[model samples]
Target chain A: MICNFGAGPCILPQEVFKQASQAVLNFNDTGLSILEISHRAPEFEAVVDETIKLVKELLNVPEGYSVLLLQGGASTQFSMVPMNLLAEGQSAAYLDSGAWASKALKEAKLFGEVKVVASSKESNYTFIPKDYEIPADAAYFHYTSNNTIFGTELFETPKTSVPVVCDMSSDIFSREINVSDFGIIYAGAQKNMGPAGVTLVIIKDELLGKSGRKLPSMLDYKIHADNKSLYNTPPVFSIYVSMLNLQWLKSKGGVAAIEQENIAKAAALYEEIDRNPLFKSPCAVEDRSRMNICFVMENKELEKPFLKLAEERGMVGIKGHRSVGGFRASIYNALPITAIHSLIDVMQEFAETVK
Target chain B: MICNFGAGPCILPQEVFKQASQAVLNFNDTGLSILEISHRAPEFEAVVDETIKLVKELLNVPEGYSVLLLQGGASTQFSMVPMNLLAEGQSAAYLDSGAWASKALKEAKLFGEVKVVASSKESNYTFIPKDYEIPADAAYFHYTSNNTIFGTELFETPKTSVPVVCDMSSDIFSREINVSDFGIIYAGAQKNMGPAGVTLVIIKDELLGKSGRKLPSMLDYKIHADNKSLYNTPPVFSIYVSMLNLQWLKSKGGVAAIEQENIAKAAALYEEIDRNPLFKSPCAVEDRSRMNICFVMENKELEKPFLKLAEERGMVGIKGHRSVGGFRASIYNALPITAIHSLIDVMQEFAETVK
Candidate 1:
């Protein structure tokens, strides 16, 4: 009956964890731990091959797109995307929605000119900025798909003639999206995937080799795509567990089915926040994150009892980010609908006591 | 009973795998899976803090040295080391030993001037080149500690007047050495540490901030060191298992005790190859890699059977690199002494059958 609501390095399905643990002992009856196998071996190659294939299938990537299971997290991609795409005198359009988007734009500025098309910083990231212009001649339009700390998201991406790059670290695989709309989509494998060692990058093959910059082989997607994700020592265990999580997604009828459940879970929690007079959600209603639901109590005195009551009832990791006070409930793909019900019940009890 | 001899991501102790599996299920009795916990939570932070402390103790790193668990493998460090240390006009000395060392050199060359102090490529990397002059004013002397494919190692590092930066990907913690001799040492976690998602970087604090170049945040060691390896989402599962492996090392009398056993194992396998007329060791005796022993069959026709027989006898993953074109027995830190004996026995049987 224990519920976990920690964000990124967040909750994974019990079954995925179980299978991953077993693989460390005996992988595919090869009698060797998955960690011990070389990437060049057929068995290990199969994992890489199948992982890419599954990722492509899940994302509905187009024919010219290549999926890479790379080392480093989304922070790495913030620099690599610019290193591979941007050139001198070419500007990239960046939407600063939160901390992550700000960091991405800062790194991009070091390489080339960056235009802040829009920003939510003025509102302390409590609302997503809607009005922005993307230049047609810009290298690309970059945006953060989901803001973990601010608990905000863009329900619909901006319409831009240029290529779009999104960092979907907090809410990848939780909803359905047309992969063809974006030129590149990258996510760190902590939330909704498995753990925090691998970053999944889906890039359009045609977009590469245009920057003319001498990029490091490790950061270049073209080199990795040419080598089939075997150019370097990959994050093996993280990629393996990610495959298991993807398999679990497929078994539950893919993102389409999971998206419906995610909608219901988020609705249940948001409903409680709206009904309780003592609690208020921070993010603008139109831009609220479905994955991470954040709220603060009107009376700060009641916050302590709310957290302690939830913990005593066996719910864990319900605390919010340090910069953003109050509580956060992270409902990733692996979090079940029943867990949301438990949190709703706890909230209702606290509401009566506060009054 | 299966013996894994793949270079790395290499074998780990069975006990470590088991205990780590338990952590994934219920970490510290928090009723939450380790994969589900937030990084800022006290429970998860404790794991990160303790793991860093354990690494410092095991290596006997000086007070000024900072240890960081980073994402990306050794290949990532190739660019990162120079990006943070080599200023625009500064020069660095590189030793060209094999494919990996050459790749490191190529990455650094893009950053600043580089001097090829020595090269073993002329001999097909069968011997380590000696009598090379290092630049007195160079920013650092860079070298790969062990060549996994070529089976050649620098038994003793050069006494450089400049600071030393080493890529110890294949043979870290396999033997004992003074930790303070080098300014910086990095190893991919797949070989001697844990799995393939994390890299351990140990650097002297004073040597940082020398490079005036604006390094990308993710590739900057000071960024992770300043945050205690929490700058972004780190490779959690890979590092947690690495902690268990390090704990296992400490319980078994640390690196010194393991080095003795590794030495004995390598001696036994090499003795068998040298005494048997049917086999020939590839590298010179003085520069042979204790971690990866490469040997060739005297009769070219026997190569197929030797590999097939070894596989059938449950001695798995002993195939050599395609570039080397011989059998390589990788006796890493976790590879048992019994596994090396089994390989020796296989070699004896093959020799008798050929006669």
Candidate 2:
């Protein structure tokens, strides 16, 4: 089996994949493909309800938070969050650490004023900026929890008086966090949840209805929250797959258990990168992502040979982003520790050859 | 096997389901689920490219038109169409025959002036309004080609002076239409394409860049067309399934052949509805949709019994929309002729019992 490490639209549990595939063929033996069923049907409603329940149970979401299954990905959420929260003439604070954060901030600027509280662009986003002050009058403090491209993560949730809005697209459910600390937490399902169609938005109920702008029905968070994300047809198959994946997570003792596994996996790879003579990890040691582990060869020429070796050894999606040409092994929730061991073995062999 | 007749997220060909299910387990033996592959990867880029090509081929999309695979469903397009097309002080004309058209007009009003050219709501949307004049100075004339809820369709494309935009969500590929007639034709993929996560937008290339409004990148059609819908992570699995469905359509002799089959299925059901003494077709015969066949028992009390009978006979999703509830049998491009025959038989049996 190929060890796929492509960031976002990354790997899923084999059992979840199998169950999802079966549902596609014949959902619950109704002889109807999951693709053919209406979202309004009880079967689909059950999936949505169960998914929300499981999300709450797994995340230990406190009572006042609402979970919504939405579409258009986290990129759309970048615009939606600002459109729904930042009022006219008001500003929101953003902590920019990577490409996605920069994009979110840029989209937010179209809706209202934005204050860059902190950014790591000066260091090419190798670390999450620390020791920055959030604006006192800001509507919300927006931050990305993990940087997929730069392979850095904010280990500590920023302490802000303003409502905290986070784009946890790459690392949600891979670790445990206090849901009560944030006003809004959104994640595209492709990374840790399930697939690429639906986005999961968990927001505090009271934070909504504050944006006074005339918003479209689809863009309005209150409408979706009131209607329970059934305002329009949802991404049914995507939500169903996400539900299955969440069930798998629950079976594995939920997020706390998975977080431990993730920590171990990240530790194994990061340890290898630090020890291997021919390689080096570019991310700040303290802020290295447990989800996306990025490293590079000491010599630029060795990059091509190492990539080819990894590919030959059944490692897929190890190539890094085009802007930063090196390597990124994204070990999501579904990726096993054994896969990391296999990747390290390949890295060690390549180092020996280069030596 | 049960016959599915839900309006959208409706039935797909068994062959397409088999292929899609296999892809979900392992896409093309790549040892990775389609859900796991990056949107930019060649594997998924190929799916997007092929789906676009098939959409063009099936619809006979004319030159100077761009087809985009977008997320957020057609409801989002209701807002996006106005955001991108209707500028300041500009009024757009809308022909409101049913719920969806009225929704589009409602969203358009959020952006600029909207002139209701005509509406069939007085007759409870049982007929399409034909003799309305398109406002000469209107930015664009918008109408839904087929009303899924009301079971009405505009059989003839309206000739308008302004740019003509049509939401063909229900009847997109079920028949042939002249592509040159429309400035924009948008459809939710759930009904006639594959599933519920993606939307298909066909816009004239020249019509873009005239909105004069700064739009969010995700909400802007021009940006998506320019980026080939890869501006952000797309609903990869949804798009992939849609591609497989389009391929199934092509294998069944493209839209031309599928149109003939669709015609036969609708005719068989309509013929049965007319002859059966216990039932009546409520939609105007001239405007009655071939995609969604709406009929009801002459006696309202018989509705529940007939629905139960259909359900018992291994038929699913035969219940009509809650707004005009009796029964709605949605026979899209993928529904088999045999399924309709079984429905007719069921109707005949119900008539005998009532008589």
Candidate 3:
């Protein structure tokens, strides 16, 4: 079996794939492929309902928060987040820890004034910027909780008074998060969730409608929330697969349970990187992402051969991002710890071959 | 076997589903489920390229147009069409043909002054309004080519000097059209194209950038076109399935061949509706859609029993839209002509019982 580790649109549980593929053939013995079913069918409505309930149960979402299963990716959310929350001349503070964070702020600037509280761009986002104060006058505080490209994460919520909005595209559902602490939390359903078509947005209901902007119905979160994410024909198959994946997550004991496994997986790999003399992690120790582990070879010329070896040995999608070329093994909720050990074994084997 | 006549996210070819399920298990023998493959992967990029190529070939899309496979449904396009093409103080003409047409106009009004040249709203959109004047000074003319709910279709492009935009969601690939005649053509893939999740957008390269309005990157067609639909992560599986479905269509001959089948199917159903004492069509005969044949009972009380009999006799999704209150038989490209015969048989059987 190939170990899939390529960034977003990454691996899901094998069982989920089995179920998804089966649904494509025949969904729940309904005599119809899941692809051919209408979004408004009672069966599909149940899928949407169950998926939402699973999200609430897994995240420990509070009473006032609305969990939305939307389409487009986190990139679309970068635009929608500000469109619904910030109007012209109103300022929103941003923490530019990585490429995605900066992308979010850039879009925010087009809609409103953006205050850059802190950014690690100069260091190529090697660490998350921590020592910054959020302006009270800002409309909201926005940050990318985990930087997939930079391989760093902000484990704790930033201290802020303004409504906190996060783009947790890569690392959501890997650990426990207090749903009530933020005004909005959105993640593309590609890394830890399921595939690349849908986006999961958890919003604190009361904090909405204050932007007072005449938003297009699709861009207005209130409309989507009010319509229960059925404002239009949703991404039906993607949502269905997501529901299957989320069901797998719940069966594996939900977020709190997966957090333990993620921690162990990260620790094993990070320890291997530190111990193996030929390899080193470029990211700052404290901020290294639990989801994506980015590391580089001490002897840079050996990198291509290492990738080839990994691929030959049944390792798939271990190539690092384009911006930061090295190797990134994303040990998400579904990646087995045994695969982590296998990656370590490859590293040791590579070191031996080079030495 | 069950026939899927359910509106959007309706029927796709059985062969496409088998291939899709196989890809979900192992895509092109890559040992990775299509769902897990990165959008940036070379193989996935090839899928995107080939899908665009097929779309161009099937639609006879001329030069100076970009075909983008993106996410969200036609609802997202309802916003993006106005956001990218319309600016404040500028006026755009709209033909309010149906509910979706009005929804598109609603979004356009938020972006600019929308001049609805004509509407049949007073008659519940039972017919496509004609004899409306096109405002030459308007920036563009927008209309929904097919009304899935009201069972009307504008087969001919509206005679307009201004650039034309169309939402061809329900009947996009069912028939042939001159792609060069419009400034933009978009469709949610759930109908004739593939499944829900991805949208097919064909944009005239020159008509963009005239809006002179700042658009969020996701809303900007140029950005998506320039990036070749890789501005961000696309709906990988949806696009893959679309490519598969399009290949199946090509195998059976292109849209022109399907159009012949569609015409035959619609003609059969409409002929029966007119001849039967129990049933009659509510839509204007001139404006009747080749897709989604809508009919109602002459005796209002027989409606429930007729629908129940149709369902019992394996005629699924014949219940009309909520707004129209009748029976609709959506015979999209994938729906076989034999299914049409089966439905006619059911109608005849039900008629005999009622008499």
Candidate 4:
């Protein structure tokens, strides 16, 4: 069996793919592809409604939170979150953990005063900074829950007086969390949810209409909140597939059940890296991400051959990012435990042969 | 046969839909669904490469024009185009024709001095203004190629010394034209290309870098152009399906052949509306859009029965925009001539019964 470790736009639930394929040919017996349906039509509306409802139910989001399936990736929300909430002089605090988190901090700065309360850059982003105090007067405390490229995660959120905001792009739905702790939680659908094209932004309704900044129609959360995601045409096919994936998550006993499986898969891979002499993980032990695993060899010459052997065994997409070159294996929400074991087996055999 | 007239996220060719369905299940036999592939990987890189190539071949876009498949829809570009190209002191010419056109004008005003060269607001935007002078010193002449809500089109582009920028959101690839004439052409894919979430921007390479503005990474056209739409994680599935639609357009004899069919379909429906006293075309004779035909009854009371009968007969999404309070039949590229005939026959029968 081939194991896919592609970082984002990685693996999806098999059943979601099956249902998505069926819907493409005929949706709701309408004799039309889901791609061909109008968002304003009732058929497409049902897809949007159910997807939002499932997201709220699965996350156990509070009564006042409004979920929006928007276009662009989480990068767009980096600008939009501030544009809709932060006024000219008001400040927001952001934690810089990795590339994506830093990019969000920079984009948010364009709209208002963005204070970087904590940063992990000094350690090459191998560790998450702790004990940084979030300002009480800041509008929100922005953080990235997981960093895909660097293989790091913020295990525990900072104690902040302001409302918490998170970009849970890489590790959403992989663990249990109290949804009410966040004022906003945004995620790009490409990582763990469904396909690319949609960004899920869940926001507390009371937190909105306070910025007093006149935002463009597309950036205005109230417009999307009032329209129920139908103010304009939405990504119909992507949202439909996301709903299917959520149903698969539900069938598998929701977040609590998946969290246990994720822990097992991550532990198996990390254990091999720790015990094996040839490989060494790059991230700090406490901050290592459950989703992405980054590792390197004591002797750099073995990296290429190790990757070649893994490919021969039908293990793919393990090359690390150019920015931080080595090897990476992303075991996202849909990555089976069998795949992780197969990868570990390959790694052990490759290390033995090289030695 | 069901006649789909829903405005956007609308109809696509059956062949395109079929191919898209196959790719979603098994993309190029990678043993993974298309939704599960990484944008940075070679498999999806090829998809993006071939898509840009096909767009150039179909449009006859000039040598220097770079095609970018971006997210956030045409609404985002309404602000980004000006943000990237228009400097604070330099002015841009805008033609206000409809709701979207006016919105574009408003966004441009936020970036630079906006010159309203022409407007059809006097007639409630039922006609396109003529003989307006485009400023020679303006950065670009911006206009909406086809107004979806108002059902007006610029049959012939205006001559301007400055670069011509167009928002072809509703009518791109529905007809043929010289792509070289415009400095930039942008379209939200929901209308004629693919689904929502992906926006196509074809920009002249030299026209950029003149604004000297510190654009955020997401809004900078130069960044995406340099990286070949990989400046960030793109909307992958939406872009892949767009490639299928473009391929379908090529197989069915490209834009020139489809333009002939489009003209015929528009003529057939408009002829019926003009000849019958019970119904009347709302747009001016010289400004009618070939893609979207807006019509109303001589007596407004007949609108309800017409919509009801049409919906019952599987002729869906025919009610006009709420702003206009009439009826609109959007005969886009994927709309077959048979559907137009069905609508025309219904119009004749309605006139006989209602009169």
Candidate 5:
């Protein structure tokens, strides 16, 4: 079987896919396809409720925070964050470390003043900016926990007096964190969770209803929280798959256990990149993402041949982002450690042939 | 197998569900689940493009119109319609026929002045208002083509000097329409199309970029259309299922053929509701929807026993909306004629027993 390493919409556990496939045809022996069932049905209600419970339990989300399954992905959340939190004259501090971070800052500027605290754009976003001063007067401090395009990740949560909001689209659930530190943490479920439809939003209940501007029902977090994410017809199938994925994660000993495996997987590939004379790592070692391990060949001409060889060897989606053209092996949670070793073996075989 | 009739996330073709279930495991023999594939990948791009093409071809959408598969369902479109079309101080006329229309109006009021020219709330929204005057100076005239909660439908497109915008969430694709007559037609793809999560928006290209107010990236229709709904990571699974459903629709001779079957199915149930002395239909005969058929028994006590009888016989989701307080059998495109016949048989048997 080919190994998939595409960034978002990356990979999921095989067992989860089996259960999800079965659910699509016959959900819980109700003799109805999950695709055809009503969102208001008790079966779907149980799915939503159980998903929220598992997410909270896995992340250790405190009592004051509410877990929500929303649509429109993290891209929509960029605008929603400022729309629901920043008032007319207010400003929100943002860290522009990568492509997604810059995009979020751009969207936030449309709603209100966006105070960019720091940026690594001059270095083509190969590293994360550190020791940035977050404005206490701002509505909130916004940051992306992982930079998918540039293969950089913020290992620690930013310390700020103002409420901290995060777009943890890639790295969420791959590692354990203190959920109480942030006002809101939103992640698109494409990576490490389930599929490319639902978004997981964990918000501190007190942080809601603070934006004075009138908001649409769908855009307002309070309405969703109040109704318990049932204010409208949710993405039922996506949520069901997410619940299944979370169940699988729990069965494999939750986030803490997964984090250890992720570290080992990353270390193996990074070691090969450092040792192999034909390849080099572009991202700063300190901020290198465990999820997306990016590398480049010493001779640029080898890139095309390397990709073809990898493809022929049953490797897929190893092509890097267009802006940073080389290779990105996105080893998400479901990507077995053996897959990483297989990629390394390919890299070694290719290097020997070139030598 | 139980037949689903409650409203959207409603019934889909059995063939579509089978293909969808297989896709959840391996999409097109690519050794990857459709959920795990990238939106930018050829596999998913093909899915999105083919779905749009099928929609345009099936509906006979004119050249100047653009079709988009969007997230947040029709609820977000309630705000997006005004935010994209109505400028500050501008008024848009609305037909307040049912619960969803009122919710749309409530959201529109937040954007600008809403002139509700007609409403059927006085009669419990059991019939569509006729011959209502459309305000000539309004930005656009908005209405719901079918009310799922109240089981009423507009038989013809409302003629207006202002641009016509419709929420065809419940009854879209169940029948053919003059697509050129409306400036925009939006539907949540739960009823006749596919599943919950994605919304189908067919907008006249010229109607966009006129609101003058800054819009969030996700809420801006122009951006989505220009990007071909690839502006962000879309609800990939929902769109894929929608594509499969549309393919199924095409295989069964498109919307015109399905419309004929829909009429027959609705007639069979409605004929039983009218012929039986113990039963009655709440909606006006002329305005009654072919998609969602509502009925009530003379003795309210019979409602419980009839529903139990229907459920025991492998029928599901026939319970009426809580607001309407009776029974609703929503027969969307995928609901078979046999299911409707079974419902009719149940109705006749119940009438004989009670009489």
Candidate 6:
């Protein structure tokens, strides 16, 4: 009955958990735990195949793109993006929207020059900076499509002629995007995907091998793409559970259907936060994230009592990121509308008690 | 009842699987699936702490060494090892005993100069190379402790003045080792540990950052060790299950007790492989891997029929690596001695029928 809603590595569908547990006992009745099975086994290859196909189908990825399920999370992708795309002496443009965004740009700086085209760091990243331009000479334009820490999301792909790379760790599957618009899209699997071990990378095939640097085999996207993400052992259980989760998503009618539900849950919760005298959202209205609904208490002294009552009512993992002291109702794809309603009830009860 | 002899992601204690399955349902009665809990959560952090402690306890890791559970497997370490230790204009010496050993050298070449002190490649890597002299002037001496594919293993650390780095992916934890003898010891978790997603790295703290290379954060061992593998979202499920597996190992009397069991199982299996006239080991006797017991048919024509019968008798993954092309009974730690007996029975039955 606990409405668990922590950030990345957050809630997955109950069915996925059940199926994953069953697989641990016996994967596809192979008489072996999914964990104990070899990655090269035909059964596992099929799982990888289906998982990749599901990602491509859900994202409507174009022919020229390769979708990879890799390890090391989005943090690894931070350096890998520039290692493959930004050639020596070339600079990459970045939109630093939050902590993760700043971290991404910082890693990019190690490989080559980085230009901060826009950043809301001065305002403590409460809003996504909009009034900035992607330098025409920059090698690529990078942005955080959704800043989980700041509760902000960039809805529109910036108007840039150059290729774009995005960190969509929090919002990849909650809504559909034009896959062809970006040269590279990487997200850690902990959020909308499945778990923390694997990451999803969608790369425009042509964008690889352009970097003048001699990259290590693991960091080379072309090597992974050419090998179909089987360049190494891969995070097998993570990918298998992700495959199950994606299948669940497909059964619930894929990304488009999930988007409608996500929007509804966010709209309801945001409305409640705005309506309740005790609560207020910390994000800009136009840029607020649909997945991670970050909010704060209007009265500072009420925060602890509100959290305690919510906990007593079985609301878990509502604590926000330390960077921003508040509550974050992460209504990711797996969170049902019922959890949102329960949260609203808690908020209303708290408001009445305070009055 | 099924005997899975796959080389890696091979086998683990049954209780670990059951517990892992239950955790997927609800981790520690937190009313949250382990897959859904945030990595930053106190419960997950405790899991990480205990896992690191378990590694140090099981391996008897000495002072000045760091034990880290990382993602990307040993293949990632193939590069990270060189990237962290091989300084510019310096050369690293490698002992090329098998395919994996050769691949490690190739990756080292990407970082700086790699000196292959000796290679058994001409013999199809059927034996561990022994007569090589590691250059004192080299950055460090590198070697693969166990060659999973070719069924060769280096049991004794080579006498080298330079820091010795070993990729013990296949044989770590199967036997006791002096941790102070090497600069680094790394192993992928799939074999003797838990599953495929996480890797174990034990580093002698002083050897890192000597490469003088500004490594990408993920590739740098110091960053991971300093952060205790929490620099980013770790492969949480893999690490968690590894902790459970390590606990199971400890309950079974830790590595010393398991070593005896492993030796007994390996001795019995090797005895059967040697006794059955139809089959003979392809690897050198002195260098034969106790973990992956590779043997080929004495009469090549009997190979297919023997494998078919073995499969019918529930002997799975006994097929040798394609390079060796006969059979490999990978008797990893969690594989009971009973499975070894079952394999011997299959071999005897096949031999009697052919006679």
Report residue A95 deviation for candidate 4 (angstroms).
2.3
Candidate 1: list runs displaced more than 4 Å. none
Prediction 6 TM-score vs. true: 0.99
Interface RMSD of every candidate?
1.1, 0.7, 0.8, 1.4, 0.8, 0.8
Error of 6 at A141 (Å): 0.7
lDDT of 5 by residue, B136-250 (tens): 9999999999999888899799888889999999988889999999989999999888889999999999987889888878889999999999999999999999999999999
Residue-level error in angstroms, candidate 6, position B50: 1.0
lDDT of 1 at A211: 82
DockQ, all candidates in order: 0.79, 0.87, 0.88, 0.69, 0.89, 0.87
| lDDT: worst 10-residue window of model 2 chain A | A316-325
C-alpha local distance difference test of each model: 0.87, 0.92, 0.90, 0.88, 0.92, 0.91
Count of backbone collisions within predicted model 3: 0
lDDT of 5 by residue, A289-323 (tens): 99998898889899999999999988889998888
TM-score of each: 0.98, 0.99, 0.99, 0.95, 0.99, 0.99
Mind sharing the TM-score for model 1? Answer: 0.98
The candidates score, on chain A by TM-score, as follows: 0.98, 0.99, 0.98, 0.98, 0.99, 0.99
Off by over 4 Å in 5: none
DockQ of 5: 0.89
Q: Which lDDT tens digits does candidate 1 get at residues B131-249?
A: 99999999999999899999988868789889899888888888876778899999998888887788999999987776878889898888888999999878888888888898888
Which of the CAPRI classes, incorrect, acceptable, medium or high, describes model 3? Answer: high
Residues A1-355 of candidate 3: C-alpha lDDT, one tens digit per residue: 5787778798898999999999998988888889998778899899999989999999999898999999878888898888888866799999999999999999888888999999888998999998899999998999998999889999999877899999999999999998777999999999888888999999998866767889888888888889888889898888888898889999998899999999999999999999999889999999999998999888888899999999988888788887888899988888899898888889889888988
Over 4 Å off, model 3: none
Stretches of candidate 2 off by over 4 Å are none
Interface RMSD of 2: 0.7
